[model samples]
Structure formats: C-alpha cells, structure tokens
Target: MANPADGTVCNGKLHNHQKQSNGSQSGNHKRNGIIRETQQNGKPYFYNKPFVESFEKVPMYLAIFTNLSYGIGTLFGYLRDFLRKHGIEKCNMAVERKEQNDFVPLYQDFENFYTRNIYMRIRDSWNRPICSVPGPTFDVMERVSDDYNWTFKFTGRIIQDVINVGSYNYLGFAEKSDESLTTVRNVLMKYGAGVCSSRQEMGHIDKHEELENLVAQFLGVEAAMVFGMGFATNSMNIPALVGKGCLILSDELNHASIVLGARLSKATIRTFKHNNMKNLEKLLREAVIYGQPRSRRAWKKILILVEGIFSMEGSIVRLPEIIALKKKYKAYLYMDEAHSIGSLGPRGQGVVDYFGLDPCDVDVLMGTFTKSFGAAGGYIAGRKDLVDYLRVHSYGAVYATSMSAPIAEQIIRSMKCLMGLDGTTNGMQRVRQLAQNTRYFRSRLNEMGFIIYGNQDSPVVPLLLCLPSKVAAFARILLKRKIGVVVVGFPATPLVAARARFCMSSSHTREMLDTVLKEVDEIGNNLSVKYSRHKKSACPELLDETSFELED
Candidate 1:
C-alpha cells in the first residue's frame, strides 16, 4: 500500500518507480535487492545491492516516503525564502513611494496574510490587548527622596513623598538594624566573600553549618540543610521527597516553586481547593484508591504540601486541621514557612509555633532568610536522616553553588539575634507593631471603601481592582503620588482578580499609615470603585500584650 499524501509506501517495503515513456526508468527505482535511477542530467546511477536489500527488507515503507517528503519540503522552503525576500523588498519600495502619511494599506495586507495561515495566526496571537492597560513606566519614577518616607523613583519623574505602605519588612529589620551589615562585613573579611563551590564540593563553610543548626533549633527541628537560594530550596526539596509511584496532595494556591517541584518529580499530583480541608480529604481518599499497594517497594507514599502563609492572598494555613488529616491518612507533610517565619507566632517562630504544635509531628519545615532576616538563601528543617539524605542526594543543593560565606554569616547573626535571649521580647514587640499597623491600615482602608484580602494579622494586604487595566492604572496613580506599591495582574493571579498588593512593615510610622490611607481614599473616590473588607484572624494569641510600644 502507498500513502497518497506523500507518495510513500505504507504497507510494503518496496517502492514503485514508474517507467518513463522514453523506454527508460525514471525517478528513483527499487526492484528485488537493487536501486537504480537516472540523474536530472540523464546519467544512470546504481545503488549497492546489500544496501538496497536491507532497505527493501524494512517492515515500514513509511520511512522511505518520509525521506522523500523531507526532500520536497526542503525544496519548497528554499523557494519560499527566496520569494519572501524578493516580495518584501518590492513591498518596502512600493510602501515608501505611496505611503508617506499612512500605512493602512500595508497593515491590511499584513492582517489578511496573518489570518490566512495557521503558523502566522499563532505567531500574531500575542498582538491583542490581553491586559487592560500598560503598567507604570520607568519614566514615571523620576523622584528620589532623601528622607525615609514611602517614595519610589519611577522613570525620571519626581512624585510627592508618600508614606511607605508596601514593603515586606515585617519587623522593620532592613532599615533599623546595622547588625546584618556588620556581620556580613566581618564574615567577608574572614572568609573572603563567596565559597565558590557546591556544598558537596568544598562549598560548606563553618558559618553555613552554624546557620543550619541555628535554623533547626529556632524551628525546633532535629536537623536542617541550607540551600544557595529560597526558590531552589522549595523547588528542589519537593521533587527530592516525592517521585515515581508517590502521590503529592498540594494546595491549589501553593507557591509556584512548589508547583514546579511537584511537576518535575513526575509524581501523581492532586490539588485540593485552596485551604479546604474537606477537599484535601476527598483527594486523599481517592489517592489511596488509585495508588500502588502491597510490597514496600511498590507501595506509594502520600505527601501533603502547603504554605505557612500564602504570599499573594495573605492567608494562613490551617495547620492543626491539616495535621489531623495527615495523621489519619499516614501521609507526610511539607510546609513552606517563607513568609510566616520571623512574622508569626509568640516569638516570631512561625505558624507551627503559634499553634504550639509539636515540631516533630510536622514532617518538613522550610523557610527563607530573605524576608525577616534581611538576608538571602533558604533552609529545610526535618529529621536528621531526611536532612542528611538531601544533603547528599538533592539535585539543586548538590549541583548548584552554595551561599556565599558573608551571606551565610549574616543569616547566622540575624537568626541568633532573632532567637536570642532578648529576641523573644524584640520579636514580640515587632509583631505587635506590625499587627497595629496592619489593623490601622485595614480599618482605614475598609472605612474608605477599599476591598482587602487575607488574615487581619497578615502584613500583606491586597486591594482588589478586578480589571487588569485598573490595577495598572491604580499603581500608576499611587506612583505619581510618590508611593511604591506592586500591581499584580494576569498569570500572577486570574485576569478578573487583578489587584494592588501592599506589604505592610513594622518600620512604618503611624503618620505614614495615615498618609497612605488618605491617598488610598482619594484614589478610590476618584475611581468610583466600591471597596469592602474581608478579614480573617489567627488563633492562640500571645500572652505578652505590653511587650512593646508603637512609635508615632
């Protein structure tokens, strides 16, 4: 049988070459165990008998036909390129002569051609306005403030000095402390900057080990392993723990890194509704039914993944309920406390600590030093065996270069300062101030008719604008007023859920909050957008109520 589409033999091994009318064989010939053909110049050509025999003996004739098709394709490609070059040159000359004031005719012709071809259609798919409007340009950020009031330089524009309401420095550690800088400088002098190698290849420094130990102790875990960066820690750790026959039950709103890690592991991943324990239970039951059973090697393990605090939504995970469900299913649990650590709990020990839950019960606790510690890198705290296993086997930790010595040292100092004797007192004070600021900002924003999301205690507050274009416009208005805030739209969140995300900080003063709320109120009124409040509170309130005082 032959394929009519490309002159390929479909069922048989031999290719049929039609004899020419000149009493000579034309095109390529195949007969018995030999291939003979006439060249374009009319010369006769012969192919090896063994080669012909082997080629003819192939079970699928489609391969030979494919090669013929490829040759024809190449010829067409060349002709197309040649024609395009000539056509484009001619078009350019014609347009230059006829269209000094307008390119309407040229544009119409392009549109016609673009719609007619599948490849062209796909190539121009991104040309449409998917988003509402363009975001604030660098040209708009021209102002630089000497005073530490909330102001960001956009473009070359000098906007007014607005209060800073959109920074993630929860404890105000970035501005108030020279401790991290001092530690980094000292470590750099002692260790000479970067370690310049992966952990497995002499990248391990004393400070790195010390910091890991400090993190483990702070989190109340048995052991800990550090990574060069936070993203790598989350992305690499998830894949290292689950693979093949294993099933991963992830929260739908888990960080992108966790999603990528689960994807790379090639595990059976089922996403429960965001923060919905019932959905999780349903998925777990289904997983048990479909998962591998019997032999230890064949039996699959179930891993539950969640974030301590969602970065975008500013919601806290219901750890107690989740733990109960995990225990019932005999599943492992992994928590990314990236945003929670140094921002939650009685002493800023994070969500697990806030609930007074036993650290041993939690299978894995991971956190980053970028936010609260005002440093870089990430760490995973777990049982000794797990940490040891990952240290040797984790792809990202093993292959990627380790954190620089100065960075590691700075993190160590920051951790020690955070967990020291006065740490509890200082941390509590910062948490209180942050809570006060958050409450004040939220209360004022709500009164002014602005919609807010996430837990009330959370520093992250999102002002919903709904339209992607409005989100960008709102950000520009805030920028013009000399306020720095981030506008999150499409891909980061759903198109319809576009918003302006504000990260409140303890470093912010009462006056700053007042000023920011005023601006927000004015903007909302001008835009005629109705605002609402959606606040959720966390449990196990701290006992030290008079630990700190808020600065005016």
Candidate 2:
C-alpha cells in the first residue's frame, strides 16, 4: 500500500518511542565511543547499534552507525549529518530546555532558527496529500494547473492510473457503488447530507440507531454506539469510562488514539511489551497488589486496552490469551479492532469470530469503519447499559457533529451484505479471498528473501529496510516501477526497522500481485534491501511458492 487512510500515527504514541533496557540505572560504562554490537535472539540483527547510550538519568539511546569498515571520525561525521538531517538532536535539545521551564528564553528566534538551520535544509518528503481518490488503482496529481496540467507517474507515462499497494481499503469498498452506494444516495435524498448538529441535540437520526443495531448484531454484541469520527470513538469515550482512580493496561504498540484516550482518562497507564502476555500478567499482578503509589489502595477500575491488529508491525493480537489474563485479573478489556474487523474470521466478524472466542468476554469492543467497512466513523460495541451510559456521558456525543445519515446507511447496507442478508455471498467471498491474498503475498515475499513482519492472517505486511535512505529509495523505486507502497520509518516504527508496508485487498488480483512481487524482487536486490542480514529461518521451508494459496 502506498498510503494508509487510517494510518494510526502511532509508533509508541503516548508512551516513549525508544527501546530502553528492561530495568533502570544500568550505569554509563562509556560515552562518545564505538557502539557495542547488538544481537536479537543471539544472532546479530545488523541494526545501527548506539554510539553512546545515555545511562542512569535521561534514559536516551542514540544509534548512529555508518560503515564500521571506516574509522571513528567517519562515525562522528555520520552522526552530525544524521542529527541535522532528521532534526532529532534539535528536538531533544528543545525537550531538555522545556524540562527547566524558564531555561528556554523568550528571546529565542524560533522561526529564524527553523528557516535558517532546520526547515529550509530538511527534505519535504512527508504529508503530500493525494488529490485523487485512493482505490485499487487511481490517478495521482502531478502539479497545480497552469494552463492545463495533471500528471500521474507510473508506467513511464503522465496522467495514467497506478496499481495501489497502499491505502487500507481492505475489502475494496472505498469507492462510491451499487447497493451500498444506492443506500448512501437514498439517505442523501432524505436527509439532504449533513445533519449540522451535535448528536446530543437534533442530529440523532433513526438510521443512526439502526446502524448501531447492525454493528452490534454483526459482531454479536448486545449494543453499540457510534461517533462521526473513528479516532474520537475511542479517544473521547475512554476518558468517560475510565477515570483518575482507574488503571490502564495498554499494549506498547497501541494507536495514538488509545494513548491519548488513556491520558485523557487521567488513569495510571502501564504498558506491556507488545503481544507479550507474560509481561502483561506481571504488570497486572503488580498493579493489583501495589495499587496507586500514594494511596496504597486498590484501583477504582482497571482497563486492559489492546489493538486487534498492530498496524506498524503487521501483527494480530493474542486475543485468547489477553482475555484469559483480563479475566484472571478481573479487569475490563478494551479491544481496538480498527484493522481487524470485517477482515478476519470465516464470516469476517473479527478476532472473536476468528478464534471462536466469546464476544461478551471483551468488555469494550472498538473498531473504525474506514478500513474494511469502506465507510467513515467508528463504533464502540458492548452491553446495552454501557452504551446507554455513554450517550449521556460521552463528550463526543455532546460536542462532535453527527455522522451523516448517508454514511450510516452505507455502513448498515455494507454490514447487511457481509452478513449475507443482501441475497449474495459477495462480501463473504471477498473476506476469504482477501485472506488468500494476504497468505500468498506474504509467503511469496518471504520465499523471495524479503524478511516480512506480522501474522499470516493479517493484510498489513511490512518488509524491513534498515536505513531511512533505503526506505525512501524503496518508495521512489516502486513508484517508478508503477507500484505504490507505504513506507514507514523512524518515529512511525522504530529508528532501525524502517519498512515498506503492503496492504492486501480482495480487489488485488493474483496477476496484479505477481507483477508487484516481481517488481519488488528486482527493486529489493537493486537497492540492496533484501535479506542480507536474515538468519536461517525454519519457516521459509514451510511456505509453498508454486501456488498462490496456502495449504489447508
């Protein structure tokens, strides 16, 4: 995928993004020296080991490696170049100053500093919004019209469509359509588009209630409440549900919204290692025993928040294990299904259905409609009472604009189609095919000597490219080759593991994927980003590359 519409912007959003030692105060053994080599699971992972790791106080680690074949002076030069290039050192300096309150004087010429030394010298590679719709293949603009100009790059031509390996249109329902499109149209005819009021006031429509019912039914929940924006559905709702006396057990890789929501709740937030259930259990046990530091009393409530799928890592949640832990701890579970709903399981009811787990085992089930539903907004599904409480208490209901009736209708119709009430198995078939696409693409990519991430069931697949330049080069090369893929680096993922993320869709044909795979294989070798560092894997032998589908 070239771009993710629902890109979570969550590489350790509220939590610290750096990878630190598991414990505190290991002590500064050395500084301004050659970085000690690092190993992952006993083998060297070829990552940029830190030149100097700040020990004891600040807990900072700077990994700047440039050609170990060269000397220490070469290392320093690369460090300086990197600092200036990413504005990372500048950011750290600002933070250090901010900690001292009046340390940053009013006389600081911020604009002048950025223009003269920072912004002007930096690359303008990010935040380039596409004017065209993000579809399976869509037109991308080249420049602002001066007589007449619209250029699309790919296939060595101008103003032509490019095959998208970007965009999180998981089920290929992003475009405006037959039944779902008609539903939206009919809704527009009746509601005349925008409601133009808060959901608390006159904005609430019959379709809103109807849509909520469909979502609840689809996910096998008692009830569901929806908000106009997907991000707010969790961020705004978390505060209302969990408060100061509560504790939030969050996954380290949770989305920015989850992090923000935890902050808003004013709860004591403790993060567990991503998908590490043992670490989660340890944290829960500790929190349960110790409670808040000052009070030494038990927490008023405890909320275990996790995502159904980790977007950046391209990994699915260990829902069954997490559920067991939550039950043992007697804590409420909040599952953010933003990337998983309508893209998992036999019937696409999400992780719960995929694992055949009890739906009610989860206290709060959250998801965004943007990915799989091909609609806007988000839903929080749980018990009827929790939803009823949120209607009056949730700030989103009182302040935010209601989701347009048309949007709600579209979601309703889409859900009906998925549930097979639309007199067709089109949606179900799409789900199965999308899974096949994911397994086939991942299996083939892995076989081609590209180290891939995420569970086999997920559509989000990321290929690791160690350096930032390689990440940029990969996006550029793939675009020139007529395939679009989303590149993630530095703050979005960890500093080292920069990768190109390819999101699979049911609309992506076997031929299209084969073309993409071939182009990517060529580019990976040309850019020298393929599995040079990959240790011998026992898994690659398991993948059958002759066919496009995984063995049963």
Candidate 3:
C-alpha cells in the first residue's frame, strides 16, 4: 500500500491506478485513493476518491451549506422589515390575500347598504353649481359686511362668517325690533332663556300654549300644537300623525324634513311630480288599489303632503288644485307653510289665504315662526280634535320642550301687529313694503338680464346660475361687493339647477336694492353671463290684480 503525504488510506480493489510525477516512476496509486498528483501545469493537487463518492453522507459540509442559506434568508427578512417601516414596501401580499377573503362578504354588505340609502341619494341628487369666483375668508367678510352696511364681527379671525339665505334676518325683527328684544329679555329673566327639559317633562310653558293659540287663530284653525323647532315639528309631527299601515302622497319637491318624517313613520309613501296634480291623482288612485277595502277595518287612511311654497325654484304651490285632488281622493291634506306664512296672502296668512280657500278645506296647516316673526318655533293648526290629538300623541310635541315664553310672546306681538285694527297699518305696512320691494328687485334684475325664478310676489328671488362653480363665483363676487346673499347648490337643489338665491328682506332699502342690482350687473357683464328676463307669467288674474287694472 502506498500512502499519500496527508496519510490517507486507499481502496485498491475499487480504485484505478494513476501515474506519479517522480521522473517516469512506474508506480501505481489505487483509484479510490487519496494521492498527490503533479499535472502538466506544475501544480500538485490532492483528491479523495472514496470521500468524493460519499460526499452526500458528509454531515460537516451539509451543516455549512444549511448555515449559509439561513444567513442569507435572515438578511433578506431584515431588509424587508426596514422597507416596511419606511413605507417603501406598500403592498403586503399576505394582507392582500386576507383582505380579499374578508372583503367578499363586505362588498355584498355595501351593496345592500347602498340599496337602503335611496332617500339619501334622492335628497343629494339635486346638487347644482353656481359661479367660479374665489376669495379669502377675511376678504369676503369685509366686502359683504361693509357693502350691506351690516355690523358684523367674528369671534376670532380663524372662524368664517356663516353665509346663507336662511341666515339673514328677513323681517328686520331679529336685531332691529325693540319689541322682540324686550320679549326675549323678559323671557330670559323669567324662564332663563332655555326650557332645559322636554315639553312632556317640565318644559311646557304658558307662553307655548299662547303662541299655539295665536297661530291657530291666524290660520283660522280651531287649535294648534307647538314643537321645539321648525324641522323637528315637521319631522316628528308628520310621522306621528300617520304611521304604519298608512299611505302618504307627497309632492316630489317637498322638504327633506317631510320626506324623513314620512319615512320614519314606516308608511307606504308615494311621491308625485313637483306640483303635478295629475301625477298626485294617479298616485292616489294607485294607492287605493294597493289598499283595497277587504273589509271596512282593512282600509287605511291616506295623507297628501305639499309645501305651501317650493323653496328651491321659489314656486308657489297651486293650493286650489291640490285641494281639489284631496277631495277627489278622499285623502287628508297636510300643508307645510314654512316659507309661505308671513310672506304671502292678504295678511301673510299663507297659501290658504292667498287662494281665499276656506281653512276648513285643508286638513292640517303647519308653519314656523323663524322667517317673518323673527323668532324660533313651529306650530301645526287644524281642527280642534286633530290639534288636541297631536298635542297628546305627537312625539315631537309631547317629548320635546315647549316653545320659550319670550318667543311665544314675541310671535303673538308680531301676529297682533300684522292684524292691526285698521287692516292696512303696522305689520300690514311691513308686508306691503316687502312685497313692493320684492317686485322692484325682481323687475330690475330681469331688466339687467338675470334669469330670476319664483313668483314676482315672492320674497325669495332666486337668480339661476346653471352651474355650481358659477353659483359659488357669483356669491364670492357679491360678497366682495359687500352683499350678503346665499349661493345654494347640491342636495338642496338639483346639480343642474344651481343658483344664487337672493332673499329680499323688508329691512332692505330701495337704495340698497339699487346698489346690489348695479353690482350684480357689473359682475354679470364681467363674467359674460347672458342676462335674460324670466319668461314665466305672474299669477293668474285674481281680485288682487284688480289694483293694477283699476290704475290702468
């Protein structure tokens, strides 16, 4: 046996012989031997024949390779962690898989949620645009407050002034009326400003009862009930009056509060086209079919709801047509005179008075005192029995705190003023002045090429802008010129019908109107707005129009 210099053994039988490098020596090394061989390159190399054959069985080499693999994997994992910490590795494959698994049912849930949100979609679908004017908050405030000669102050420069048509004091009763101020003072002194409890509890005050009576008397109804607020009154009263198993035939353009109230009632609700008597009649007929009389007890009552005046387009509801439909369908009529009372009719008694329709013809008459009375509260007047029923049963009136004593007193005072002994004095004078102002403003805006909507007699003069961006711009420019007007869009009105709603107040002077008109014309010209006259005819010739004919 020949041994290598490293002293390794060789297997002769399984090995093959190889030549040595010592000067042509005829020596043979075993094939499976550990030997040193000199190659042609003059390098001596060592090879282990048996060991190479069994390399897979070597534990030491396997361990070394396993360690190297693990080290590389650990380094990669650290790098991944670093990237994740810095938000560089955005997509988490594992998380994505988990999310997909979780989202399948969630997606279905979302679909169901959207289906249930139909009313929300309907309410929001009418969002429209205005103008594209822009400016800083401070700049807008300075312009509007100064131009309108209004005394305005912000609690801090950081807060912006709340600008909306609803925010303006329409009758000048908010800040200008001494009587109103005194009433509030007396109420605060006596009742401490707030009721501090719901009406059913300790909030029912004598002032509330008095105001309810006054409202009922004004509307020529037997009795009335008051609520905490206008919206609450609508939302709570409508549903409380007619809930489950009842049907509600509502105008398409009715206020959101009415819609919400009907929905909350869980009643079958059918919406007719805006002021379309035919559609209302069709719906009423269909309701009869759905609620056919299996028995006398099985038949359900129907309620037809309409606004006295549509707020968005400033259109007055055709009360006569609606009343006729109600009579035909044998349905109860509920009129929300929120925007009409104190702004329409002979003594501002609203739609019924405007049409000279008997109060008995209508089932329920609801109104708010925020606008003309310069106070905050709402009431529903109707048959004494119905009013009493609502007072005891309507959740809005029963649970909510009654109207403040001061507000009630103020409203009563205002109502008394409106119904002066001479009929053409006091609040009547204010009404006339306001109506004349509205007419003058509408005519001037029409002459200057603005598309004005609503009845000429309406206090609400909406200048159509057609785009939300344009409406915003018109508002910004007006504010820049010191005019505090409202730009209404989206959800309030359809997106395609966005407008700059100018609510003319009795407090606004002729000089103020002229200045506003001139500024509006200048702005319209600069913006290339095509000013056009409103093509709609005024109300049909009633006895009231005889004044103009007689003068002619």
Best by TM-score: 2
Candidate 1 local lDDT, 1-552, one digit each (tens): 323322212222112222232445345433222222332233222111111000011113433443454456447545654565577422221234344546435434343331222222122111111111111111222433332212224344333444445555676666423553776787788899778899888888788778887777777677898888899898887888889889888999899889999999899788998777789999877666655544334337899999988888777776767887887788999999899998876557787655445566689988888787767788898799999989877987789999998778767766666665334466556666776676666656655655565665567787767543355567667766756676664456753455678877767777777777788778887875443422221111221243223321
- For candidate 3, write residues 185-213 as lDDT tens digits: 77778877677787778888787777776
lDDT, residue 412, candidate 1: 74
Per-model tally of clashing residue pairs: 12, 6, 31
C-alpha positional error of residue 259 in candidate 1 after TM-score superposition, expressed in Å? 0.6
A best-first ranking of the candidates according to their lDDT comes to 2, 1, 3
RMSD of 3: 38.8
Every model's Cα RMSD, please?
A: 26.5, 13.7, 38.8
TM-score of every prediction relative to native: 0.68, 0.77, 0.68
lDDT of 2 at 292: 85
Candidate 2 yields a Cα-based lDDT of 0.71
Candidate 1 — number of clashing residue pairs? 12
Q: lDDT at 35 for candidate 1? A: 28
